[model samples]
Target: MLNNVAVAAVNGVTPFELGIFCEVFGIDRSAVGLPVYDFAVCAAEEGPLVVGDGHFGLTLPFGPERLEEADLICLPADRGAPTREYPQPLLAALHRAVDRGARVLSVCSGAFMLGAAGLLDGRRCTTHWMHAPALLRRYPRALVDPDVLYVDEGQIITAAGTASGIDACLHVVRQEQGAEVANTIARRMVVPPHRDGGQAQYIRRPLPRTACDTMGEVIAWMARHLAEEITVEQLAERAHMSARTFARRFLAETGTTPYQWLLRQRVLLAQELLESSDETVDAIAGRCGFGNAAALRHHFLRTLGTTPNAFRRTFRGPQAA
Candidate 1:
């Protein structure tokens, strides 16, 4: 049902994020039996729009009126500072699109434009974890969850960082066309159909440089031994520190306890295995150090709010089940 699509082009838009919108919706895949959207990049102002470097620019054929025909509108991240104001015409078109029941999606800091449009007010949304604080300060009425890769608030979808834009697009495809279509598109892109966890697990929240001499080395060792059951006492021995000091330093450096970090790593590994391999739940559970299917299920549900098998089905299809 989501056939028409439009990407709002603003000055200072990041070329890569804008290309994500073009890649997902602008391309014609109808020969392979995929939906072909009526897509265009629309500019708020009429004339040559300057981009990143002032020397280079784009000339969009359509204007903000094009957004009226779109079933979905994509806002790619702009390099303009988060505090900069978007064109009022572009924001008004966005408001009209949503008022007519169309969906709007933002990639990374594009959430700033949505916030400017007042679309994110009182809604759960997200942007890149690095910019989440600024977004929260700018739009206090908006509920920002920096942990997740993306947040789907019915008509509005806000995604984190560059690649999560693909994930968010594929999610909309899966919702509209089903898992099979989404999987096929992902295959064409050579990216995972789905990924687990939030940007929390991916953000490089490393220990302080001073502390990394000891804690960092242990963290690297822990990553290598994710499949093995690790105890903080054993880790303390390995670090040549007492249990209390090890625990204290672990929290200070990693911002999480040893057990919590290990559990998150295990869950992340399980997710990768579930998406990439046809292995049974028990096999994956053991491989990820969960020991059994039930344990994997418990942790998967706890972390992702879904069972492993269900997650697999959502990504790999029912036949995989």
Candidate 2:
């Protein structure tokens, strides 16, 4: 159902997110046998646009009218200035896209544009976790997730950060073409076909020195061992501290509990295998330590807010796997 792709950029479009969109949808990947999109960059008003990069600027010839022709519209990670108001035409076009079945997507702060259109009202959405508070403050009606890289609430999709845009865009690829194409594109881009971790896994300065020091290394081990039932007690044992101390420290270190961390990692691994490999739901669940397909679906929905098959279809496409 997806074909043409368009990126909506206003006056202050951030270069990193613009590059992310261009990397995923703007490139010509026909040589890899993927469907080529009708890619265009549009602005609220027609004129030359100065991207964040000062070296060069992009002159856009199209306006809000161009978004109507796209099957997918990508909004960059940066939006309006804090002291300024949003352009009316861009918001209007966003509404028009939804009215016509055009998928609306936002990378990081771009959620603002979609929010302004009232498209995210009552629907789960996300932006960079750092901006979650501000977004919630501004758009109280929007359900924002601060832990994941992205949230796909069926029609409108929103991603969590500057690089999180890559995850969101790869998702668009998976939805349009298939898992194989998405993986191929990911390889070309030199990023994981899908990130096997979440923002919760990277809580930043919150983690204490000793615990935070080995957190990244520990995460790698945890991801590799999800198929085995590793308890908080066991994780604490491995950390060489008492269970009570470990539990408290882990919470202070990760902003989440060991149980929550394990569940998220399990689901992320399950999603990756489901997309990149030809595996059954039962097998994927078992491999990811979910015990069974039903259990996997339950956790997937509880945490990621989506069903396994639906997630696979969005990330792996309609293949037999």
Candidate 3:
């Protein structure tokens, strides 16, 4: 039912983020049996607008009035969104759009605009990690999760930096339409249909060194033998330490218990098999050391908040399933 879309073009808007909205919603893809949105780019004030890159400008076809009728309102990143104040009328327009049941999405630093409008108050949201501290400092009530690619809070969605906008947009499409439509759109765009990992997995942080080199060696062995049932005592024996000592050091080094870490890695392996291979659920569960499909389902849902079948359908599409 989400057909009409509009992007709010603020001055100093990042061209790539603005272009993401146009590429995803503005194009007419009806020939491929995809839903074609009535998309438009609208500005806060009429006339020529300067882009963020400082070397170029753009002219929007419509004004804020276009946002009034849109089912989805997209706010791409603007260079000035961090410190510059938004126009009162523009903020009111965004509030009005959401008040009447329209959804709003912010890409990267565009989350700053939503925070300024007070839309992110008491809501779980995220911006680019570099700006997350600033966002939290600016809006103390906003629960800013910096480790996610995007946070979906029903009517409002906020994404991390740059390319994460595509993931957020596709999430909306999958929710409104279905995995098939979302996958088809992703195929046309030549991006992954669905990314299984969160931004935390991609964060480049140096691991803390342990007192001994035993933890790393044990971890490497665990990864290689994920299909076998692993025990803390067994791992402790392999690492030449007591079980209690191993458990304490493992938590200190990895921030999680040995059992929890092993379970999570097994679930991650199951996800890869479900997405990239034509394996049966029972077979995958066994390979991942879950013993059966029920066990896999239990762990998968606990870890990822979704079932294996749903995850597979999301990545492989309807016919591929």
Candidate 4:
């Protein structure tokens, strides 16, 4: 129920993931009947902030003073930062925020910061894929699930690296503002509204339904009709099963819920288009059944934790942008 969010733009700000915080939670969406946040970008040391890839320098009038007012405090990822020694002043501010009922979050390696502070001593969290092992090794007391995009533990949350932060942010939105508002933001951002964590993270080979028969027809249909209005009942009817029966069967066969399976297909298609096709995000969203670029961005953030542009840059090679 707090209105403001203060995101820490630490040294060597990964501009893209930090920007995800701006897009999802920072910008006012009240006109669209979504919750609005009082967003401020603050630096530990005020004035000229250096960004990744020599992007831009930013300055903020307020430093950590804004932390006292924040309902949520964000620390963007730092791949190169220390795992065990977060500065004392920042840790104190984080401790103070948490003590006062504010939630503290980190993106990717930002979990390292929280872990180092001893806050994650008994919590479950995640970080970027590459750093997950190190994080778990560094904090054995921390239960780290490396494959999921993000983890939500009510008062505290942590996300997988980079774009996974966006997923964590959307999760917050859904919790605070409800599914409708979260969907609206997703529409505006051109991203998928929700992607359940149960979806496959490393689906190298698509699992077939059986040795002879397959749910192949249904999955293809689901992917093709992503923009169409779908319901459990609708899908169940297509498969000639009752809703209850189909829900159970779907989870058993696909290892995820019906809605989640559709979302994963949409994300996969979007990833392909984002990589192989030269289409803009908006066009890709429409093509991939996300409705718009905003909707695509929402899902992309949830699954990948980075913006379309940023993802494209990385996909095209580190130097593309």
Candidate 5:
């Protein structure tokens, strides 16, 4: 039912984030039996708008009026979104869209625009991890979850960072159309058909300082030996420290506990095997140190919100799965 789509562009919009919406919805992909959207990019502000980095300017044909007919409205990240004020007309359009049951999605800092419009009030949403704190401070009522790739609150979808915008858009497609249509579009785009919105964003943490690089070596060993049973006590011995000290240092360095870090790595390994190899789930579980398919399934579902077989089908197609 989501046939009409519009991207509301303001000055200083990030080109890559804006392109995410254009690629996902604006392209004509009906040749493969996919639904073609009536899409437009509307300038929320006056013409000759400058893009991020001031590299170029855009003169859009559509304006806020185009948003009136859209079933969904997209807000891409803007360089000045954190502090800049959105146009009154644009904000009014957003409120009207949601009031009429149309969805509004924001990519990265574009959530700031939604916050300005009061659309994110009392809604659980997210933005890029770097901007989550500012978004929360600016809009105190918006529940910001910084870890996930996106948050879907029915009429409002907020995606974290850059590529996660693709995930959110495809999710909307999958919801409104079907998995086959979403998967076909993903294939055409050469990206994943589905990445769970709940999946953690890839945030890099600084390594913990150590006098002799012992903890670094231990973590390297842990990654290398993920297929084997690992214990904090054993890792502590290898690092020449007590179990408690090792656990504390691991948490400080990785921002996660040892068991959780291992579980996440094992799930990642299982995903790689599922996509690249023909190994049975039991075999993969053993290879990843899960010991059995049941354990693998439990942890995989907890971490990725999808089963191994389903993930394989998503990446390798149904016959491959």
Candidate 6:
């Protein structure tokens, strides 16, 4: 259903963020059976638009009128987004798109455009952590959560920083088309197919005191053994540190506690199994260390806002159920 896509470009648009939309939606991937969108770069302003830092200028073929036909509108970050005022016509087009059920996505400071349009009012959204305070100050009604990689408020998806834009875009593809299509595109892009929207935007940690002082091996081991029962004390023993010290170091390195990390990894593993295999919920529950289908359902609902069967059906289709 999301066949027509348009990227909205204004003055001082960041090339990298714009490229993220182009790379995700503008490419011709029909050769591999993926949906090829009717895509264009639409100029929101009349004159030649300058890219960030004045590296280059773009004379976009499509104008604001092109946005009216799009099923999805992408707003990429601009250098002056936090303070600059968006054109009224451009903001009105955004309002029309949302009012008519089309989705709008903003990458980094692009959220400012949505805020300026009043679309972010009363909606939970996010921007790059650096600009989160400004976004909140400028738009007090918007619930600006600065920590997560992205926030998906159904019609509006806001991604934090640069690379998380890829995550948010892929998330839309996976939701609209299915996991197989999303994963294939990710393989073509040489990037991970999914990073949960709830993931920390950035880890709070100082430079490593020593090259060898890290939780890399422990984290990798945890990932590989998601089916096994994992405990903080056990992980501490493996890391060769006291339980209290290990907990502190793990939080520093991972931006979450050991239990939360393991729980999230288990959920991710369960999602993969549900999508790629015809495994029963009970079977996957055991494989992902949930022990039983009821336990899996509880955790799935808590973490993903859906039950195991419902998630499987979403990705694998109703026939899967």
lDDT of 5 by residue, 1-321 (tens): 999999999999999999999999988977889999999999999988899989999999999999999999999999996988889999999999999999999999999999999998899999998999899999999999887888899999999999999999999999999999999999999997966524441444343344546577887788889899999999999988899998998887777898988888888888888988999999999999999999998998777767888877867998987
Residue pairs clashing in model 5 are none
The regions of model 5 sitting more than 4 angstroms off are 196-201, 207-321
Q: What are the per-model numbers of colliding residue pairs?
A: 0, 1, 0, 20, 0, 0
Identify the runs in model 6 with alpha carbons over 4 angstroms from their true place: 196-321
Show model 2 residue runs off by greater than 4 Å.
53-56, 79-83, 205-321
The most accurate candidate by lDDT is 5
Candidate lDDT (C-alpha), each: 0.88, 0.79, 0.87, 0.75, 0.89, 0.88
Q: How far off is residue 188 in model 5, in Å?
A: 1.1
Instruction: Please report the candidate that would top TM-score against the real structure.
Output: 5
Query: In candidate 1, what are the lDDT values of residues 1-321, reduced to their tens digit?
Result: 899999998888788898988998888899999888899999866568777556588999899999999999999888884978888989888999999999999999999999999999999999998999999999999999987889999999999999999999999999998999999899999989998766764454432233477787788888888889899999999999999999998888878889989898888888788888989999999998999999999988777767788777767897887
Evaluate residue 24 in candidate 3 and report its C-alpha lDDT on the 0 to 100 scale: 88
Q: Per-residue CA lDDT of candidate 2, range 161-264, in tens?
A: 88889998899889877899999999999988886545653443222233467456666667678899888777777778888998887788778888888887
Residue 169 miss distance in model 4 (angstroms): 1.0
RMSD in angstroms, candidate 3? 6.3
TM-score-better candidate, 1 vs 3:
1
By descending TM-score, how would the candidates be arranged?
5, 1, 3, 6, 2, 4
Model 1 clash pairs? Answer: none
The residue-by-residue lDDT of candidate 3 on 261-298, one tens digit each, is: 88878887887888889989999999999999999998
TM-score of 1: 0.68
lDDT of 4 by residue, 54-114 (tens): 5677777878777888999998875355443556667778888888999987987888778
Instruction: Compute the lDDT of residue 64 as modeled in candidate 3.
Output: 88
